[model samples]
Structure formats: C-alpha cells, structure tokens
Target: MTEENRLREKVCLLAKSMFDRGLTGGSTGNMSLRLPDGGLLMTPTGASLGRLDPARLARFDAHGKHIGGDKPTKEHPLHTAFYDTRSTAGAVIHLHSCYSVALSTMSGLDPDNFLPPITPYAIMQLGKVRLLPFFRPGDPAMGEAVRGLAGKRSAVMLANHGPVVAAKDVEAAGNAIEELEATARLTLLTRGMNPRLLTEAQIRDVVTTFNVEWDT
Candidate 1:
C-alpha cells in the first residue's frame, strides 16, 4: 500500500484504540496526520473515533484546503496551529479526556506549566504543558491561544475542555497525550496529600537527557 493509505489506517487504528479505552468518548476527540507531500488526513467532524472509516477521513491539501472526504473537524485550526508553528510536528491530537479536563477546572495551577512534576515521563514526553483559558468549543480563539506559546509547548490543557498534544508522528503524539492524562491523573489523586515530586535538579537532568523543548 502507498504511504498515505498506511497513514490513513494508522489514524483510524490509533483513534479506535483511544476511544475504546475511554480516552475520549462519543465524538469528542480529533486527530490529524501530516503526509509526506504536505497534505493532511484528519478525523471527520461528528465522527466517533471508535468507528472512523479510513476512506471517509477528511483530506486537506498542503495549502490547508479541504479537498475531499467528509468535512474536517471544526477545530482544524487547532491542528494547523501546531503544524504551522512547529516545523517538526507531524501529528496533532486533541482529546476531551476526563482527568485532564478535571485538572483544567481547578484553580491556582501554573498556567505556563499546568501539569505537576509527578512523573519523569510527563517531563520527557511533554516538556511543559500550557493551561489555556476556556474557550467555547470549536472557537478559533483556542488555536490562537496555542499559537501564543510560540511553539515552545508541545501540549496544552484547555480549561474546562481537555488536552491537545503535538508530536513528531502519530504514535508519538498518541503516547505524549496519554502521558499528559496519566500525569494529570496522578496530580489529582495526590492533591492535598503532599505527594513527593521530582526535584528541580532531577527535572533538569531529564530535560537535558531527553532534549526536551523546555521554555524557561
């Protein structure tokens, strides 16, 4: 099969995996993969990730035009923002995961670094997750919020919404977002219990070792 067909199948497979595992339910998540030739394949609007038809996935030209298939997600701008700002980003995943969304609703968290240092994996996979203020679902301003980070952050928690992650490929994006949710789950579970977090030195070491995109 051509590389494009392979990628199309990959998107559907990963999306179904996440959906079946309750990462995102109903029709609440969206994902996109950048083709080698600069085109894009995105999950269709209102389509359940658990049952996406590879052939019906939305297609976009390199110029960002929707050329075929069903209509793309209304939050297509969110996916494009990362691709536009981060040259290395090959895939973007946005999910309304439970723990992350719950964490986004809490107060006094660091807006620039929303997730706590509960695990090294979160730091290694996601340098620093930004916490963007709540925007109405599908609002273009959500994309603008991600753009304001200047590509330093690979992930962001949309307040009262969920998490969005950008990575070098479809698998990496999926893994990173899962790490984000796991970290958020840890943060919530350990809240008010004074969980021992990784020290700043350890965090620095992980960042150095992983070449994390840390924005000080």
Candidate 2:
C-alpha cells in the first residue's frame, strides 16, 4: 500500500485503540498528522474516535484549503498553531481524558510546568506541559494561547478541558498524551500522601541526559 494509505489506516487503528481503552469518551478528541506533501490529514468533527473511518478523515492542502474528505475538527487552529510554530511537530493529538481534565480544574498548578515529576517517562515524553487558561470549547483563542508559547511547549493542559500534545509522529503523540494522563492520575492519587517527587537536581539530570526541551 502507499504510505498515505498506511497512515490513514494507522490513524484509525490507533484512535480506536485509545477510545476502546477509555482514554477519551464519546466524540471528544481530535487528531491530525502532517502529510509528506505538506498537506494535512485530520479527524473529522463530531465523530467518535472509536468509530473513525480512515477514508473519511479530513484532508486539507498545505494552504489550509479543504480539498477532500469530511470536514476537519473545529480545533484545527490548535493543531495548526503547533505546526506553524514548531518545525518538528509531525502530528498533534487533543483529548478530553478524565484524569488530565480533573487536574486542570484543580488549584495551585504551576503554569510553566503542569505535570509533576512523578516519572522519568513523563518528563521525557512530555518535556513540560504548559497549563493554559480555560477557554470555551472550539474557541479560536485556544490556538492563540498555544501560539503565545512560541513553540516552547510540546503539550498543554486546557483548564476544564483536557490535554493537547504535539510530537514527531502520530504514535509518539499518542504515547506522550497517554503519559500526560497517567502522570496526572499519579499526581491525583498521591495528592495527600506527600509522595516522593523527583528533586530539582534529579530532574535536571534527566532533562540533560534525555536532551529534553526543558526550556523554550
């Protein structure tokens, strides 16, 4: 099969996996990838991740024109912001995962780094998840918020919403967002226990060893 066909099938398969595993419920997530021709392939609006049809996924030309497939997700701006700012962003995933959204609603989160240092993988997969303020769903301002980061962050937690992650590929993006949710779950589980978090020095070491994008 051609690479594009493979990608289409891959997108559907992975999205279905996430949905079946309860990462996101109903029709509350969107995904997109950068096509080799500089175009885009995206999930359609109002479609359940568990039920996406590969051939019906939205297709847009490099110039943002909808050339084929179903209508793109309304959060296209959020995806586009990452692609426009971060040259390395090959795919973007946004999900309304319960744990991450719950974390976003809580108080006293570090805006610059939303996820706590619970695990090294979280730090490596998602360097620093920026916590963005709450915006009404499908608001274009959400994209503006991502753009304001200047491509410094690979992920962001939308207050009262969920998490969005940009990575080098679709699978990497999926893995990173899942890590974000898992870390949030760990944080919530250990909230009152004063669990041992990685020290600043240790975190710095991990960042250095992994060559993470700790700062913009």
Candidate 3:
C-alpha cells in the first residue's frame, strides 16, 4: 500500500483504540495527521472516533484548503495553530477525556504547567502542559490561545473543556494525550493526600535525559 493509505488505516486504528478505551466518548474527539507532502487527513466534524471510515476522513491541502472527503472538524483552526507554529508537529489530537476535563475544572493548578510532577512519564511524553482558559466549543479564539504560546507547549488543557496535544506523529500524539489523562487522574486521586511529587532536580534530570521541550 502507498504511505498515505497506510497512514489512513493507522489513524482509524488509533482513534478506535482510544474510543473503545473510553478516552473520549460519543463523538467528542478529533484527530489529524500531517502527510509527508504537507497536506492533512483529519477526522470529520461529527464522526465518532470508534466508528471512523478511513476513506471518508477529511482531507486538506498544504495551503489549508479542503481538497477532498467529508467536512473537517470545526476545530481545524486549533490543529492548524500547532502546525503553523511548531515546525515539527506531525499530528494533533483533541479529546474531552473525563479525567483531564475534571482537572481543568478545579482551581489552584498552575496554568503555565498544568500537570503535576507526579510521574516522569508525563514529563517525558507531554513536557509542561499549559492550562488555558475555557472557551466556547469551536471558538476561533481557542486557536488564538494556542498561538499565543508561540509553539513552546506541546499540550494544553482547555479549562473545563479538554486536552489538546501535538506530537511528531499520530501514535506519539495518542500516547502523549493518554499520558496527560493518566497524570490528571493521578493528581485527582492523590489530591490532599500529600502525594510526594518528583523534586525539581529529578524533573530536571528527566527533561535533560529525554531532551524534553520544556518551555517555561
């Protein structure tokens, strides 16, 4: 099979895995893959992740034009913001995972670094996740918020909404967002229990060892 066809199957497979595992429910997530030629294959606007048909995935040219397939998600601007700002981003995933959204609703979390130092994996996979303020669904302002970060953050928790992650590939993006949700779940589980967080020095070691893009 051609690379594009392989990638199309990969996208559907990963989306179904996440959906089946309850990562996102009832058509509440969107994903996109950056083709080698600089075009994009995005999940349709209202399609359920669990039931995607690879042939029907939305397609866009390098210039951001809708070249084929079903209509792209309204959150296309959100995905494009990362591609425009971060030259290395190859895929973007946005999901309304329950744990992350619950964490976003709580106060006292650091907006600049939303995920706590509860696990090295979160840091390794996600780096520092930004907790952005809530915006109405499909708001163009959400893209503006991501743009304001200047490509420093690979992930952001949309306050009271969901989490968005950009990574070097579709699988990596899926893994990183799952880690984000797991870390959020851990944080909520250990709340007020005085869970021992990884120290700053340890965090630095993880960052240095992984060569994490830890933008302050």
Candidate 4:
C-alpha cells in the first residue's frame, strides 16, 4: 500500500476503536493527521467516527485548502490552530466525550488547568490540559482560543463541549485524548471521596522525567 493509504487505514482503525469503546458518539468528534507532504487527512463533517470511510476522508493541502475526498469537518480551523501554533503536532483529535464534558460543566474545575493531577500518566502524557472557554461549534473563535495558547498546550477542554488534543501523530493524538477523558471520568467518580492523586512532588518528577510542559 502507498503511504497515504497506510495513514488512511490507520486513522480509520483508530477512530473506530475510539467510537466502539464509547469515547465519542454518533456524528461527533473529528480527526486530522498531517501527511508526509504537509497535506492533511481529515474526517468528513457530520460523519461518525464509527462509520468513517477511509476512501472518503477529507484531504487538505499545507495551505489548509481542501484538495480531495470529502468536505472537511466544520471545525477545521480548530484543527489547524494546532498546526499553525505548535511545531511538534502532527495530528489533532477532538471528542465530545461524556465525562469530560460533564466535568467542564462543573463550576469547581480550574479555568486555566482543567484536569487535576490525578495520575502520573496524565502528567507525563498530557502535560497541562488547558480549559478553554466555550464557543459555539464551528466558530472560528474556538481556533482563536487555541491559538492564544501559542501552541503551548497540546490538549484543551472545550467548556461544556468536548476535548481537543494535538499530538505527535494520529495514534498519539487518540491515546492522549483517551487519557484526558479517562482522567476526567476518574475525577468525577472519586469526587469528595479524597482520592489519592499524585502529589505535587510526584507530578513534578513526572514532568521533569518526561520533559512535559507544565505551565507553572
């Protein structure tokens, strides 16, 4: 298979796995991966991850213009924000996950940092997940919010909406977003129960060891 075909297959398989496992539901969530040629492969708008057709995925040039397959997701600007700001990101995934959305609705979570340090893995894999204010779906303002971060954050929780994550690759994007959702779920499940989260020193150690981006 050609390299593009391999990326198409990889995206479809990973996206379906996320859907089947109930990470993102029907007609929700979107994904994009930068190709070797600086083009992008993206899920179509209004298409469910569980039903993504590899042959029909959207394609965009490095200039962010659509070049093939299907119409790109309406939130294409949001995906492009990461690429425009972050030098390392090669893939972006946005998910309307239940637990993460629920947590975002709560008033107690920090506006600057969404996920509390619950596990070493969250710290190591996610760095610091930002909590961006809500924007109407498809609003270019959402991209602006991410851009304001200046690409310092790889993961962000869209208040009352979902989480968007940009990673080193498509597979990494999937995994990091999963970790965000799982951590949010755990946070809610153990609320008021005094769960044993990683200590400050522990988190600091993980951040240092992983070269994670912890913005104070």
Query: Between the candidate structures 1 and 2, which one is better when assessed by lDDT?
Result: 2
Candidate 2 lDDT over 1-216, as tens digits, reads 999889999999999999999999999999999999999999999999999999999999989899999999999999999999999999999999999999888889998899999989999999999999999989999999999999999999999998999999999999999999999999999998989999999999999999999967
Q: Which stretches of candidate 1 lie over 4 Å from their true place?
A: none
Q: Name the lDDT of candidate 2.
A: 0.95
Q: Which portions of model 3 miss their true places by more than 4 Å?
A: none
Clashing pairs in 3: none
TM-score of each: 0.98, 0.99, 0.99, 0.98
Candidate 4 residue pairs in backbone clash:
none
Candidate 4 residues 1-216, lDDT tens each? 999999999999999999999998999999999999999999999999999999999998878788899999999999999999999999999999999999999987887778988888777778888898889999999999989999889999999999999999998898899999999999999989988878888887888888998964
Q: Which ten residues in a row have the lowest lDDT in candidate 1?
A: 207-216
Decoy 2 TM-score against native: 0.99
Give all candidates' CA lDDT scores. 0.93, 0.95, 0.95, 0.92
How well does candidate 4 score on lDDT at residue 95?
Answer: 95
Better of 1 and 4 by TM-score: 1
Candidate 1, position 34, lDDT? 96
